[model samples]
Target: MSVTETTVSSPLPPGKYYFSGNEALAEGAIAAGCNYYAGYPITPSSEIMERLAARFAGLEGRVFIQMEDELASICSVIGAVWAGAKGMTATSGPGFSLMQEAIGYAALTETPLVLADIQRAGPGTGQATKVASGDLMQAKWGSHGDYQPIALCPWSVQEMYELTITAFNLAETYRVPVFLLGEEAVGHLQERLDIPAANRVARRHYQPGAPPFGHPDPAGVPSMPAFGQGEKLLVTGSTHDEYGFRRTDDPAAHARLVARLNDKILQHRDRIVSTRSYRLEDAEIAIVAYGFTARSAWLAVDELRRAGKKAGLLRLRTIWPFAAAEIAALGSSVRQIFVPVPPADRRPDHLPGNHHPGGTGAVAWPATWKNTCARAPTAPRSVPAAATAS
Candidate 1:
């Protein structure tokens, strides 16, 4: 149901309402002080744009534009961020495919914005309505270069609201484009949404007379200056100095810029990455899952526990900037780590979960997954690994 209907039908206060994941995401963005939005309508994620357009219509200083295409949509979002507005855009797989280059630009320029890839199945628009986590690795590496990705996955409609807000916070904190890696199902699923007060979300601090991309602090994140702020900003996609001066030929400048881009997220991985555990204190076998697939993994883990098996779940709330330390801890505690991956042909070349080793004796289950632990014959296939997740 739409937010307009909730007032008359359900009598909900501003903090509480019933809605779909897509609607909740739009609401979260507004609550996070996102005043700018630009996107092309696409499956699953299009609802975000539609809802935001309606919301922005009645609010001042809020802008929502329906761009001509996906590429233009992402470019506009990054431009909006540089223009001093917290901006976002949403799309499905094919549209997401078009936004990769712009996302890379945002990464190189250290622009703070959010992109929601409410993923559908695809290599090239293969399935418009199908739900899949096929974009997991793409969210990490699709843009290319050595940029660090901060991607979040939401398994349920409620988390859809929560993580959308979290995505904005992380993007602003790191001055990078953070991704909300949701799935088709989550976008359409309906549930109760508990929205925190708008003042609770933090905004990025702007410092005048400071270098835009210069890391004067040890945190690796630099102070951001919005456009027209009289900070003399010169953001670009090429290698540049903190003063926004280009130095593409200077190896040291290139190296420093790239390292800062990577380190800002990696060095703060512990703070950026988040994962949820279920009965994992003493689990013998752990299932690694995220997005829609995680729902089944939780159910299977519950069933395994009922069957007297020490099975647990490690659901990835943050898919990128991989939760290395958390995975390492799971490695020493669990004997086997089973990932409910998509069919072999549909899998991404790399994932944020690939960092762990030694203890995780993981196997990729096929597309024909059931609501239970691995089948009797499901083992030792695709990208061979030794031991378990360590």
Candidate 2:
């Protein structure tokens, strides 16, 4: 069976503790009332599953299972959540790829689940232990349909804990899948994390006997009923009516289903998307970044300021729904905006003044840079200094 009994400690108490991003994510999942964990071990993300495996043991009503693969891992989480349990799973790059189809399935069914992707360098297993922010695009478009995704990028171990809880809350609130995108460097890096005495968690809305598929309001989230709740639920990835009847041949039915899915998040994007500004006020140059690179970029801005340059940092905490308004706001104030990318990314097409392929107009992405906390200042200087000379 998936449930097993063993002697282990209960959930962590409120206090400061040293934790890797993966460990903090496990604790954060617990804090968010996640009682179901299912995943296969993958580098940079295995610790989350391992810790939950130990912690879930002997805890009443909690379940932990080592699934056969990533597909099973995500599918099982979807099942657990529908059974009225808060569920989560963790994985790295390749495993994230495997989970994509199910992610799309979850979106169509409006399943509330949290997925932590501890990112590693890769197109196809390029470097399992190395850090990369390459999955930023995949997290949104990996699935085959036109569904909106909520993705958060945690730059440090502290955020790894807090944002996992936020991810769960957002998922339940919107009745959609949410992603916590963590880079390998931050996932393995140990740092201080403070557990608060109490956290506010959002529970799913359930209106028993009401239709669970379509909402009366176009941008509304429908009430989700658990499997054994006697609601006569008919969940499917195919197009269905508000009463959950299959309507495959009806174009109107398909359009309504698809539009609601996108509208729910689109209308709520302002609240769902999050960003932080460091030294942006009254600055001439701005650097946009996310994930672990944001930490390096923060240091770069500080170094530039010390050298009497007006540099600022805009760190994207939520990536999907793509932070357009924030980037557009920066464009109005800054003379130039630099998005520090890894040296391996040589896409000049992603530069400033070029339309983003994703259609966020003029979203600037620097051509390339070598990133590390120690060498952070070099990247900020290299690009902007050349622009200044011309």
Which pairs clash in model 2? none
Q: What is the C-alpha RMSD of each candidate to the true structure, in Å?
A: 5.4, 5.4
| TM-score winner | 2
For model 2 the TM-score comes to: 0.91
Q: Write the per-residue lDDT of candidate 2 for residues 106-219, one digit (tens) a residue.
A: 999999999999988888887899887788778888999899999999999999988998898899889899999998888999999988877777788887786889788998
Score each candidate by Cα lDDT.
0.78, 0.83
Please, what are the lDDT tens digits per residue for candidate 1 over residues 146-257? Answer: 8887899998888987788789888888888999988888899998887654434657767678688878554477777788887767888889998999998999988888
Models 1 onward score TM values of 0.89, 0.91
The reply for model 2, stretches above 4 Å from the true place, is: 1-11, 346-368, 373-390
**Alpha-carbon deviation at 233 in model 2, angstroms:** 0.7
